[model samples]
Target: MKRALPLLIFMAISGAVFSQENPIGIFEDNKDIGNPKLAGSASYDETSQTYTIKGAGYNIWGQRDEHRYLYSKVKGDFVATANFEFEGNKEIHRKIGWMARASENDNSVMVGGFLHGDGLMAGQWRERKGADMQNPEDDVWAQKRYQQIIQLERRGNTFIVRAAHPGEPLQEISSKQLEFMPEAVLLGVVIGSHDENVIETARVWNARIDQPVAEDYNPGKDGWIGCRMETMNVFDGKRRVIHEKDGRFEAPNWMPDGKELLFNEDGSLYTIPINGGKTEKLNTGSADDLNNDHCISFDGKMLGISHNDGEGSNVFYLPLDGGEPKSVTQQAPSYLHGWAPNNKEVVYVAQRGENKVYDIYRKPIKGGKEVKLTDNKKWDHADGCEYSPDGKYIYYNGSKNGGTMQIWRMKPDGTEKEQITFDQYNNWFPHISPDGKWIAFISFSPDIELNSHPSYKKVMLRLMPTSGGAPKVIAHLYGGQGTINVNSWSPDSKHIAFVSNSKKSVKVD
Candidate 1:
């Protein structure tokens, strides 16, 4: 944080009116608000609307071990204004004013003025949580300061901090864009005291918030877009293009040796080297007409796919080396989603009734009667199902509770069910990590009002700790439909393989 002051025109306004009769809501220090155990004291005068503090051992939050102040019940966006004149012992680390949490003792998106022992005032605008402190290029909010009245304002996700000399116009210190949690935040102001050049008095006035007028708006435009690919490296964040062309290419699954990627482009199955090069067509013959969902077996000896053969879509398996396809399901309206970890079974979403509602079902890979896994009647459309690495759980995303799609997990027998993700965004396509410590998924905002479907535009790929916590966005780009984990973990778990479309559209071959 840096310290620089905004210039102020010396209007002949009386201090009484500025402190007491001000329009914005104000709170003055009354009684001894400073540390009681210490020798310091703080009091407020309602007539002057000024809060003053004097003595040693005085702090904002009453903590004696460190110089921290805590103010609670701070709701909405507001400002804190204070004036301090101090004669402190020589120490460059002394701070004048700052807003922070009472418990953790950390600075937030607020105004902070620091007075170095060398007599220089520095100011800064900080976003500790959102900052990429390790990479300076990615740390857009990090800044430094010198003498200044600092005004910090937060408008929605954007935070602006400015400073100016006692009489000059405020100079912009720094402006940082941030996504703050929608909860009440704590705020405070404090001065760190060192050695004893001590007799000093401070006056704080004009501290209040100016909340913006409410308006109906879409906040999703500011969200990150996820890169959609069938075989994406989750750890390294690399997208491999197996069968990209002038048209749509999708659902890539890795070969057993991880040397090549198999996918569907223009309704035909094709194979391409994992390292990127020309693709070789896998002869689908009369079964060439395929949908966007496909998979490879654990042994890499077979390919299972869903395709429309003149009549309707059906699940089929073919030899990886290329051969006649074997129909695995006669069930009507079945679309392949994923294969079991053992390669002995496959999960598909089957449509039921005239409403076209879908429910998850599984059947033997070698052909057997389908077993219903989820019997919900609320249009339970399930997609991207995969077995946990340990084989204890099956993770998938489904549309339930109206249009809100969320990631869910169930036991192998579809017994114990649980819903993940409570945020307002539409989360889908969950893929658990091989280590089982994390789950990567795609999220699209359903709050956007548009005539078109919600999944068509920008989306985000996020990762969450398997134990449960807020998901962090890892990649932002355009994509949807066929994103999934199609292969085992790279020996290191540092990369994932998934399919994605090229930025430029290509004609279908």
Candidate 2:
């Protein structure tokens, strides 16, 4: 009996330790805050990359609170986001969202963006430890509801909350400056049931933590941030991360066969299975100074690249299976962006003569007079030129006299130019899908310069009908420049591959 008792005690201790271990997604630990009458639990499902949190608490209001928290310590500025959906039982006041707290104590000072069971979206906070929670009445909380995704960001001592529905742009809900908050604090997802006796369950997914770079940070002079390779379903707006790297990688090009994706890292091209496995470097032979401006031919038999030639970039082509690259353009500074449907010619952006203005041009691969497609002299700028699937139009980003950049399409000869996007944001790189029904593009915030698409910035991947309509946001991520510089749509036109950045490095696998 003594031996059995000792074994039982050991098992209980082991179970408790296992519960505290942090093996799930991005969290460091999972535990209940305030110790509710009924214990709370948190779990992660690897298959779906989803988090399920069941919590019992009287409420996350008034002095002292109870909830389940899956958290890690973060210092300085950071942004956290998650999509939440409550399940089973419901109470109007039950809450689920992203949180930043001063400590683990139930009455600690905290601020968060939350969604209530009855479709209430708000930013709630406690200014001081052991103080009652303050929401709409004390601040500018969102009155309208039905938002399922919540984001919380901290800059210095100020915290802001933003919420949005799937496939929509996030709208600011509220902001608060907590002067007493420390530089380092607990940041994670939290769940609470308004009634202590009732346990509420909620599923959370697409949780992300990103740390923004300084205003003057330079990716080339400074260093690059971690990269996340992701593919998203165009119809349902669901994203699946295929791989992550601690350093820089950019501009994923979906192979025509749809079995793998190719991207550039450290001036070398590499390929990885779409589902992510071993990363194999593509043989570029002597042409290794490649940039993000690389794409696969429509027929899937050729690869086009922009390699740095001493002073500037030049277009080159090689077999998709990798071999010695053959020069396509003698002009330095020429960047390959698209290939003609005939496969005998390629489209690029370059400067010629005394104009010195970057414009779209088409040249035969076998050597011929390069035909200029855009005449954006004066102060106008043009780049990211690509041909539509049927070769009916050439899509590109352009600005008139240093104005806001927007997607524009023109005929093969650069005639009948027409603006396709009318948003205030700066849109760049319009990639037409394989089916020619949809156009995917990246948009930078309106605050950014009209002619600049810098790296390590807040951007959105948006989708719109090729025929034209309002564009809907598919993904909001911290990336720019190399995020989607080339055509990345799967052969079926159902998914797209792109890269996002984060300060926190993730597991390579």
Candidate 3:
């Protein structure tokens, strides 16, 4: 059933803007390639951060290609991802997916992940200008089309594409390396109609372009990238950028009052309205060398923090509004993670004894002997030890024998230990929702070290039922250590606030 593309007229779409220049979400330009018989158009919904591209082309196959591209020029290593679906399509050759090209010439050296109307997903590439397009002989034919997210990553001369359905982990589909490929390329969303006079439309959402730091790149030495303060609806998977800045900031803690969010930047704490506005720094007295490890008490009356006191990081507590922090741990390197539901005690990770292995420990707020919660092995590590809202269990991320990190839970008395998630990814920071019904956590690829949660990497924020079920990917972006170290769920449990990183200097009003 070869179907022709139809040009649908859309006017005054709610919250959407039809533009080719200025701000189009993350893209910088939108243009049509090859000048098809009929024109093409693109739109972006700022509220949903989604893109809709409509194009008419005479097949993007063979020697030359024609399509609509909404793109941004990216250099070096980068990862582009989006969830896309065509509208009113029947042509099996209609194409839509992520693409990278050396130039906008009608026939240019390019590589892209393409999803055809007939459920054929393949990595297509052109070796040189005016060359015939080529794809791997063995292509993935999804049983359910447009139900997965497409990710295209570039590592030097190599390009790779990976896809995953909802509630599942991403699996690599295809990859290729071209020696002639340039360092900079037009990385973006692409759509094409199989016929010249017809137009095809697609809606793409959750679109992200992440420029990761090098393996040896150090923020303090190489300079920091930009930051985006974003909130996402857990159920709908819709993200809204509430704030942006040109520096480093991490770990957003949703204020219990649900009006503002607290985060750490430049070793200090700052608060911003949930809807986006100016940031106000919190007065933490002299305890300024703070890290991302921080949490708000269940009662919302006090704030627990991990501050470096010239020796090492230690746990401290102060009034939620503003005040001098009081020391909670006598030992150095005690990082705060969670506050007891009773608001009388707090849990943190520390290295004691000669082995110096990190493990979970609990202590009273007023001051008392710290009780060791988990007796990890010499090589084992534990972090993000947070208590559920009902106080029934303490959820955290633990790694043993230098393996991948997995989510685990224990009783407040450090009993009834159980491992919740078992996968290849290094899952971290099990933050239970305020209602205690879901556990939201951040995940890193298996390639990363099991013991560390480094910043500036491709990561996912996942959600799963507290009782037990397959975790679903709630947000995919470039972030890591400072992304969601603390519980950032809105008080109503409908939204989550987190930070994402990018090398581009973007400021959303």
Q: In candidate 1, what are the lDDT values of residues 73-150, reduced to their tens digit?
A: 334443443334445454554455544332222223333444434445544433443332232322222243444344
Cα lDDT of model 3 by residue, 48-106, tens digit: 77788999899777678899988766667778887888899568889999998887787
TM-score of 1: 0.52
Query: Each candidate's lDDT (Cα)?
Result: 0.51, 0.83, 0.82
1-509, model 2: which lDDT tens digit per residue?
A: 00000000000011221234664567877888899988989898876678999998888878887998888776678778778899975698899999888888888888889898888888888888987665455446586787988899888989999999988998999898998787777788989998989899999987888877777766556666677888888887767778886677889999987899999888899999998889999999899889889988888899999998786789999999999999898887798899988888999988888887788999998789999988887778788888898999999999998789999999998799999999899999999999999999999999985577877677889999998789998887778878888899999999999988754432210
Count steric clashes of candidate 2: 0
Q: After superposition, which runs of candidate 1 have C-alpha atoms over 4 Å from their true positions?
A: 1-233, 236-244, 448-456, 483-492, 499-509
When 1 and 3 are scored with lDDT, the better candidate is 3
Best of the candidates, TM-score? 2
The reply for model 2, stretches above 4 Å from the true place, is 1-20, 134-139, 504-509
Q: Rank the candidates by lDDT, best first.
A: 2, 3, 1
- Global CA lDDT computed for model 1: 0.51
Estimated TM-score for each candidate: 0.52, 0.94, 0.91
- In angstroms, the error of model 3 at 114 is 1.5
